[model samples]
Target: MKRLLEFLGFLAVLQGVMGLVHEFADWNVGVVGRIGFLDGYEVYASVALLALGGALFAVAESRRSA
Candidate 1:
């Protein structure tokens, strides 16, 4: 669970960063436009994924400490 959380957290952070870069910087690293993926939706998805990842990480740490 801990490993899974860590991995998920990292991926979420990466997704957020990518979204930011694609939205503000106008630089799509992956098949964003080619695959018909929109940055407008990415921003919201990024927030949700990041929040979920953070919560998972916190829960994992708390469990480890307990």
Candidate 2:
């Protein structure tokens, strides 16, 4: 379960990053709506993913040391 969470976290982070880029990037030209709601969602997902990834990384590190 922990490993699975870690994997998910990584995916979330990726999604978030993509969202942020899309939201912030000046690629709003010639596009309808001017802003993608998905990008906003990505930002939220990224934060969650980062947190989970951090926890997983810590656990793995501790196990390796042990």
Candidate 3:
């Protein structure tokens, strides 16, 4: 379970970073247009993913510590 959570967390963080780069770096994540609103998608996604990753990591760490 810990390993799975860690893996999922890492994946989420990686995806979030990709989305952020796509949104802010003038890169297209898909066929989508590049605009502020579009960029916000990346921002929001990154934040959510980072949060999830952090949560998972914390949970795993706490479990191990216990």
lDDT of each: 0.66, 0.52, 0.68
The alpha-carbon deviation from the true structure for residue 19 of candidate 1, after best TM-score superposition, in angstroms, is 1.0
- Give me the runs in candidate 3 sitting further than 4 Å from their true place: 29-40
Count of backbone collisions within predicted model 3: 0
Error of 1 at 43 (Å): 1.4
How do the residues 1-66 of candidate 1 rate in per-residue lDDT, one tens digit apiece? 677777777777677666656766878653332334653576676666668778877867776632
**Best to worst by lDDT, what's the order?**
3, 1, 2
Which residue runs does candidate 1 get wrong by more than 4 Å? 30-39
**Candidate 1 lDDT for residue 38:** 59
Q: Rank the candidates by TM-score, best first.
A: 3, 1, 2
Q: How well is each residue in 1-66 modelled by candidate 2, as lDDT tens digits? A: 556555665665555455456556844322222345644455455455556667665665555332
Best by lDDT: 3
Off by over 4 Å in 2: 26-66
